[model samples]
Target: MAEIVALFLALCVQLLALPVYVLSFLGLWDPFCKKVFFPFFMEKTMVNYNQKMLRHKQDLFRNMMDFADPSGKLSVLELGTGTGTNFQFFPPNCRITCTDPNPHFKERLAKSMAKNKHLEYGNFITTPGEDLSQIPDASVDVVVCTLVLCSVKNVEAVLREICRVLKPGGAFYFLEHVAAERSSWSFFWQQVYRPTWALVFDGCSLTRAIWADIEKASFSEIKLKHIHAPFPWTPIQAHIVGYAVK
Candidate 1:
């Protein structure tokens, strides 16, 4: 219905936007990433839209927390911490290690990170999901992925890595915008829009069945709760927030 139409229109916008982005990037007309990617998405993306969704995503992660080490001793590792939006929510007793692939935003990430200096120890590592083998197994109590898995280079490896790092009962909490429920019109728009969308955003695929893949990664205690973003429905952009216990 309306969602299908919007998806198709969004596809058209992406198709036309590709060349414009290339020409602009080449002409030294660099558009600040904040315009389309970072800041813009923080407001426009499904997970970040309603103020309630923000808290809800946090609550989902907090549920996994076991503060055995007191306020300053517990550690949480967050993936794709772009502009590091989730940093402020951590308890003063907790330290957070965050990672992202976009080195271009180091300064901005650092600036945002400064606020958390009072916390015992916090680190922002420049890395991607594939390289997470370095994090020790059973080390992190909570792994938070907020609107992040869509763009990762290797989804399968990342999930395995998350499982490896998580303590036996640790949780994998996420807020993701996933592939639309199947429909002719919705499917058509997603196919058409995918190429352009992938180019502008990080190789994010609109068609990936993220939930199924997460379960396929061999997580035994999987919990899925489907809900919509409190806005216009776009098939591939609907918000789903839930956690999987390891």
Candidate 2:
């Protein structure tokens, strides 16, 4: 009976991955990935998984909020803000600007914004995380990122962008899934499955040493710690949560 269930689940994965593969090759992966696949992910695994991890990372989230301007008059920019799931965690009345490469997320983001009345929605820029030319230098007070760095082509470039947009003493709060410890069996599995994983998940690399990049960036101070979450959908369970000050 277990073997039968395993085979059935294997078939389901292939069936779901097929459309993503086809759309990727056709160069329409972004819209389809956001419109279809991301929502599917949110419903199937992300919602539940994030709920559990939220408990583990609650203190980190609180620290992020505490860094915000107590007067609720700060500009907060969130890079790679898919569907605006982090909206509820931010402090109320802060100016919120969300940027994502996938334009399709704008609608879903709007829905989330409507529900998150505490956040004052300012802009929804259709820009990738690696570049933030539209935002002025040293103009943002806070930058919030979650589960996003693994997918960018150049983690250094994105970190540089984060540093650029942040005001002096501004805080960058991030929670990213990163490559497992080099000594672990999970690291080996991550390397083996990374290519196909990226193909299906819109270029999300499970092998990025994101914490290392964050540490080496021009941040004045970094308070980060490693963590692990056991989620069956992906092998990249190792994570880091922290805040960096510019």
The per-model lDDT (C-alpha) reads 0.69, 0.80
Maximum-lDDT candidate = 2
Error of 2 at 165 (Å): 0.7
lDDT tens readout by residue for model 2, 1-246: 544554565456556678766777798976776678776675366567668787755676675555556574778899988878887777665888899887776767778888999778887898998889999999988998888898888889999999999989899999988989887767766765665577777788888888889989999999998888767556868988889999
Model 1 lDDT per residue over 1-246, tens place: 666666687767866796756755686323555344554455354335535566665666564445334443667788987766666666666667888776565665676677766444456677898778668889987788877888887889889999899888777878787776677555556666776666556567777778877878756687777666554444455556777878
Candidate 2, clashing residue pairs?
A: none
What is the model-wide C-alpha lDDT for candidate 1?
0.69
Enumerate residue pairs that collide in model 1: 71-93, 72-93
In TM-score terms, candidate 1 sits at: 0.78
User: Which 10-residue span in candidate 1 carries the lowest summed lDDT?
Assistant: 63-72
TM-score of each: 0.78, 0.85
Per-prediction RMSD in angstroms? Answer: 4.3, 4.9
* Model 2 TM-score relative to the real fold: 0.85
lDDT of 2: 0.80
Model 2 alpha-carbon drift over 4 Å, by segment: 1-31, 69-72
